[model samples]
Target chain A: MEIPVKTPSHSYAVTIGKGILREALTAQHDLFTKADKIIVLTDENVWTAQQSYFEANFPYIFEVHVMPAGEKCKSFENYNEVQTYLLKQKCTRKSLIIAFGGGAVGDLAGFVAATYMRGIPFIQMPTTILAHDSAVGGKTAINHELGKNMIGAFYQPEAVIFDITFLHSLSEKEVRSGMAEVIKHALISDAQWVEELLEGDHVTELPEDLLANYLAHGIQVKATIVEQDETEQSVRKYLNLGHTYGHAIEAAAGYGRVAHGEAVMIGLIFSLLLSEKFGKVNHQFTKRFLHFAMENGYPFEAVREFTFEQLTEYLLKDKKADYGQLQFVLLETIGQPFVQKVELEQCREIDRQLRALLAEV
Target chain B: MEIPVKTPSHSYAVTIGKGILREALTAQHDLFTKADKIIVLTDENVWTAQQSYFEANFPYIFEVHVMPAGEKCKSFENYNEVQTYLLKQKCTRKSLIIAFGGGAVGDLAGFVAATYMRGIPFIQMPTTILAHDSAVGGKTAINHELGKNMIGAFYQPEAVIFDITFLHSLSEKEVRSGMAEVIKHALISDAQWVEELLEGDHVTELPEDLLANYLAHGIQVKATIVEQDETEQSVRKYLNLGHTYGHAIEAAAGYGRVAHGEAVMIGLIFSLLLSEKFGKVNHQFTKRFLHFAMENGYPFEAVREFTFEQLTEYLLKDKKADYGQLQFVLLETIGQPFVQKVELEQCREIDRQLRALLAEV
Candidate 1:
């Protein structure tokens, strides 16, 4: 199936299916045919696991550059290496880049394409379920020593080609991490989807068709938010529903140690904990969500490892933080997200409450 | 005087006047008051020359990051240092960056602003005559190891404040280097302006008022083209009239050793040499322009240092070079610029002619 995204700066589509890499790319032949070259930027893990499959199915002739896996691929050093590689390969404005891994590779490759020759055409061939969210949105970045996604651009891709056959190789931890974003989409956009998920089988055990459906739904939710606010000047803040506290946890854990979506899942509960007092969300629902998260083995142990004060340092560095005020995306109820300026004092209070709740669970 | 630049991504103004840095910034009080912090990215030379004047005129408290002078400021190591500085200074998305120097400083700072937190607002405070052209359009970049501007983004600035008072402190070489771009602006836009420049006193010796007028005219020409083609997808390529060969020589000379616009002046002569054969441009006119350049001391000596063979490697690496075909911006006549795909053999012919003519002069 195909989902179209229309932003002020770009208009592209997300083509998602099982074993559709060759067909999807062939469909977008015009984007490839115009390019003087095509470069596939992947990571060691993804390339090692899926190179043969990719090579067999990728219709076009292209060169490939393998990077260190996970958040390491998003570092400033890696970002520079990719550009140097492109320069060495003589990639030009006409060159089309294929971001051929999960979120890390997508972020790094998207950013490289955005800046290479002041911008070039690129497509997202996302290999992980986590990338269902990232690859669709044009938020490309490299990490600064001080923060994640700190140095980057809102450069959209020409298309996002998600061939789910690649996801067959994901580890259990990867599946749990990827599902957090899928769950995040459900939580922010549809209460019915959230309910279905809460009562469903293990997140990693979702049937193939159901997994694709959920991924498609999550992408649609993200695409709608992104279309409304391409640069996150306004409505797009809602998409960060679980990210405020989530990113702090992720950053404090030093990235990769706590997977991005895993930390986001923890943050989802943190937002819910805050939502209880600030919005119409019930303590009962927050508790049930916590129960759901625990049963799914979302690592809440990482939270105990860092004190709120330590996490607070990273929290203040958030891109969404206006001045010193922490801006969070909190649910009025499931499916309705709003931005709120929470003081450091209230955040500390919620952090304390979250720990107490996690201890009981 | 104000020239409005209206590009699809942005709309800003070029405020050009003598000694108006204080007033120009004051007029944009809204932009200032909104920024949580202000960062001034400049070079040692510029800060030393005009720090007192800037501090006296600037209305706000700003942290200054004085970098190594010239192209050194745009190196990858320095780009990383500036980001670390901003992170240390706790600069958030609300922070505003002041690109307060010539083209190099503006390019570096503009790029920093472009990527920091996925972009922050920035203003160009040009401290030299050449910046009247560079400061206007939002072409921000850093130099890669392989090529100049191989790494960058097309990020627009909020406004470009050209305080020509800063030019009073420039050295003779800086003056000559800067006038080349102003001359280029005239060449691509107005035949009358070109004739006026040809008949005028030595470029660096023009009356202060006349210099300001010429800069303003150059900015207008640039602004118009940028409004139409901000990304160099169309008419904007005309602005790169001499940059193909100019960048080759600039890169061949290893940056800082040769002033950018000086190399451009040499490339301008090369382009005119090409136009004589390919367009209606007369050989006599090219000679007259060369004579004008000599009287103004444009340093054609830089060109003699690198042969066509030596420069060919860099020329092939030109951002505009596609699949070994050189894309040169040539004039059909004065004020009428068009893009042409010239082969290497023809480029060699032009190189020979340029050398023979330079030897005569």
Candidate 2:
């Protein structure tokens, strides 16, 4: 299935399906033909697991730079290393970059392409279910010591080629992590989709076709929001439904520990709790969502590990934070998000409530 | 004087004149009022020389980050440091950045603002004459170990405040370097302007009002071309008339060793030599241009310091090189520019001619 994304800066498409890597890549012949060199930037884990399949199906000669896996791949050091590699390879503005891993790899590679010679073309070949959300949007970044994704750009890819075949090698934890974004997508765009997910099989055990449908649906929600507001000036804030608090938790855990989607899952509940006060959202729905998240095993225990004080530092560092007030995307109801400015004291109250709910559950 | 630059991505004005900094910055009250924090990113040299003038004129409280002077300010390490500093200052998307230095500081600061939290508003408060070209174009970058401006983005500034009063602190070499671009603007836009410049006083001894006129004229030439092609995909390539060969010489000599415009002066002559062979340019005109360059004290001796073989690596590394073929913006006539793909052998022939002309002169 092909989903078209149109932003003010550029327009491209996301092709998602089973075993579509070779065909999807082959369709982008024009992009490849113009490139003086094609560079594949991936992580050690992804490269080791899918190297042969990628090489067999890519249908082009390219150089590969394998970085350390997970959030480490999005470090300042690794970002610099990848740039040096491109320079050594004599990559120019006409050279193309292929981001051939999950979110971390895509983020790092996309940013590298965005800034290398003041922007080069890059394609996103995301290999994880989580990337269904990340790959479509132009939000590319590397983490700073002070915050997760503290440095980045809203540079879109020329195309996104997501072949579910690559997901076969992913661990169960990765599936659970990826599904959080899918759930968040459903929450922000379709109440019926959220209901279906709540009534469905274990997120990790979903049928292959069903998972692909969810991924496509998530990309569509993100694409629509991005089209309206590419720079997060307004409507795009809805896409950060769970990320503000989620990033704080993720950053507090030193990144790669809680997993991005897992922390976002935790943040979904936090937003729901805030919604209960700021919007028409009910406590019952928030509790029900929390129950569903716990059933999927989203490491709520990580929240207990860090005190509200520890998370406060990271929370205020959020890109969404305006002045000292935390700006959160809260739901008026399922499928409707609104931005709200919440005080630190109110956030602490919500933090306390989350812990108490966790203890009771 | 106000000149408007409208690129497809953004639109802003360059406010140029003597002592215009105070009034120009104050006029941007809306931009300043909206910013949660205002940061002035400058180099040690600029801040040391003009801090009092800047502070007294600029009617706002802002945090200042003073970096290493000159090209050293564009290093990857310094780029990282500037980002870190912004993060430490807790600068959010609402923050405004002031790039208050020459081309190097503006380049570094603009890239930081471009990528910080995925871009924020920045104003170019350029201090040196060299910045008349760099500040208005929205081309922000930091130097990579492998190449100058190998990593950056084409992010436009909120406004450019070119205060000619700042030029009083510049050295004679700096003035000569800055005038090379003015001459280039004239070469690429108007033949009569070039003739007048050829007949004018020594570049360093030009009257103050005339220098300002030349800088404004240079900016208008740049603004018009940039408005046509913001990212250098088409007509904008003409703006790089002397930069292909100029960058090679500058990079070979090491940045800061030979001032940018001085090397561009050398590149201008090289382009003229190439023009004599490939276009309607006359050999006598090329020689007269070379004589004007030597009389004005451009460092042609630097070209003889590096052999064509020594400069070949940097030449191939030029961002304009497509699949190893050097793409140069050559002049068809005094005011008409076109791109040509020249082979290494032909380039060597022109290098020999340039050396012979310098020796004869």
Candidate 3:
């Protein structure tokens, strides 16, 4: 599968397929043959699993920087370590960094490569299913003590490799985490896919073709918004459908405890409830959303525990806030999202409804 | 006076004047007027000197982050501190940062601004004569333990305010240190100005009109080269005319002992001698270079102390070097510079010639 990511400098391709990891490596070497050096940045976990495969296949003099696996390691300290490695190894302006793991590795390595020499060529070899969203967007960043992705850049990668063969190693929980982004993609744009996802047996695993189709649909939906507004000047904010609340949940309760996708799953349901109260979507739509999300084993009581004031504080500090007013990706209906500057009172009302929804849960 | 820096995006103006310091306060307000808040990153020296001015003159609310003053302060710890401050202040993407002071403050603050929230608008208000080189270029970075300017980005400023008023209180040594860069500009591109500078008294006071002409000439020469190759692809390497050898002298001597410009002066003389030894220039040309450099009172014996091997190591690790090859910027003739890769043997021969020439001191 091929998807286009729109950015200011150039557009890029996101290629998704099973057992395509080694093939993508070959293709990249062919494309950037003129490059002087090739660097691959992956975590210890990915390196343990696949370093030998890459070393055996790559034609270039490949070097690997093994970062500690997880969100906690995405600090300036790691960024410094990667920079030191590049300098010591004599990586130059002509060098290219291959981000060859999940979102954490991609974000850390991408940011290090982005600012290393004021931007260099980087390719995303996303190994996890969740990265279907992270890999496509040019949003590369690292966490700060203050917030998630507090420091980052909108640096686009040259290409993205979505090899499903790597997905075989993903635990059940990882797959579910990835599904949160997929659901968010459908809610923001594709109504048909949402119907398909909801109709499936929540207990059973998705067939290969069905999963690929969902990933492709999600990519296309995101690609459309990004194509029109690459820098989040307008319509692209729709893609933040559940991130406003999702990021808060992840931040407040220490990251990695609840995977980003898990928090987003809950955030998606909360948005649906808000949508119903705002009269953009009816009770039928809300029921469908809750059924799909609950069947996936998303934690709803966590949302119930969140106080209105807590959410308000997080929203105020959000990047999307305009003149201190929180901007939200409110659903107009299923497969629709719009940006709105919601007042504190309006947000409180939404919070009140969320508490009621939690009582039912 | 205003000079234009042409980037692919848009050509922005750089202003140089007295009392322009006040104008710099609100100059970027239009671009950042809708900002949620404003943050100022400065050093103890600048904060003490100008914090009150900012409070009295600017209509908008602002906060200040004071860092230590010097080249050594551009560290990862400082970057972390700035991020923490911004986070604690609840600075969102809408906040703007103003880097007020000399090169260290600008470089450190610029890197912080470049990576914070991915990136935000930042303005440069340079207060030293040395900043003529640092301020104009979009190169914002921090020094690492292993190398100088090892981590960085090519992020341009929203605007640059070169207030000459600050120079009025500059010490004689500081004025002479800054003249080194001015002399470098003259040596590389303005031969006629070199003759004029040689005829004048040492720049004891840096009178406004004379300093203005010298600054304007240097800015024009630099801006022209930068315009042609904003990212140092080709023509911009000419600006490194003296830096190749100069940085080695500064590093080996222990930083801060020999000011940057003073070291650059020695490097300039060495480059001229190398040009002559390689048969690129006549003895008369080299003699004229020595005459003006010596008359300018820049230290000479510093280059004599370091061996070719030490200098070679610095050049190899220089940010300008592509891969392991040392990119030496040699004068094609006075008023022209060209970059060529030099190996250890070639650099050794050049160092030998430079050592012999320093016998006059």
Query: Per-residue lDDT tens digits of candidate 1, residues B280-355?
Result: 8999999999999988888888878988899889888888877757999999999999899999989999999888
The order by descending lDDT is 2, 1, 3
User: Model 3, residue B188: displacement in angstroms?
Assistant: 4.4
Q: Interface Cα RMSD per model, in Å? A: 0.8, 0.7, 1.5
- Model 1, residue B219: C-alpha shift (Å): 0.3
lDDT of 3: 0.78
Query: TM-score of candidate 2's chain B against its reference?
Result: 0.99
Q: Can you give the lDDT of residue A73 in candidate 2?
A: 93
Error of 2 at B105 (Å): 0.6
| Segments in model 3 whose C-alpha atoms lie over 4 Å from true places | A30-32, A52-56, A201-204, A277-279, B9-11, B24-27, B49-60, B187-195, B198-201, B204-206, B277-280
**Per-residue error (Å), model 2, residue B65:** 1.4
- Candidate 1 vs candidate 3: the DockQ winner is 1
Candidate 3 residues B1-361, lDDT tens each? Answer: 8888897543666888777766765676686676778888889977777666556655677788889888756887887888899889888777888888888899988888888887887888777888877888788888878877777787778788787876655666667778888877887787688788777766655568899878878887788877887777788888888888899899998888788888888787767766775537676767666776677666776776777777777776676777667777787777777777777777788777777766754
Tens digits of per-residue lDDT, candidate 3, A32-144, equal 68666888899999888877766765667777888899985587778888888987788887788999999999999888877886778899988887988888778889988
Docking class of 3: medium
Which parts of model 1 are misplaced by more than 4 Å? none
| CA shift of A162, model 3, Å | 1.7
List-wise, what DockQ does each model earn? Answer: 0.82, 0.87, 0.59
Name the lDDT of candidate 2.
0.92
Q: Candidate 2 on B1-361: residue-level lDDT in tens?
A: 9999998888999999998888888889999999999999999988999989988888888999989998889998898899889988989999999999999999999999999999999999888888999998999999887778889999999999999999999999999999999999999999999999999999999999998998999999999999999998988888888888898899889888899999999999999999988899999999899889999999999998999999888888888888989988889999998999999999999999989988888
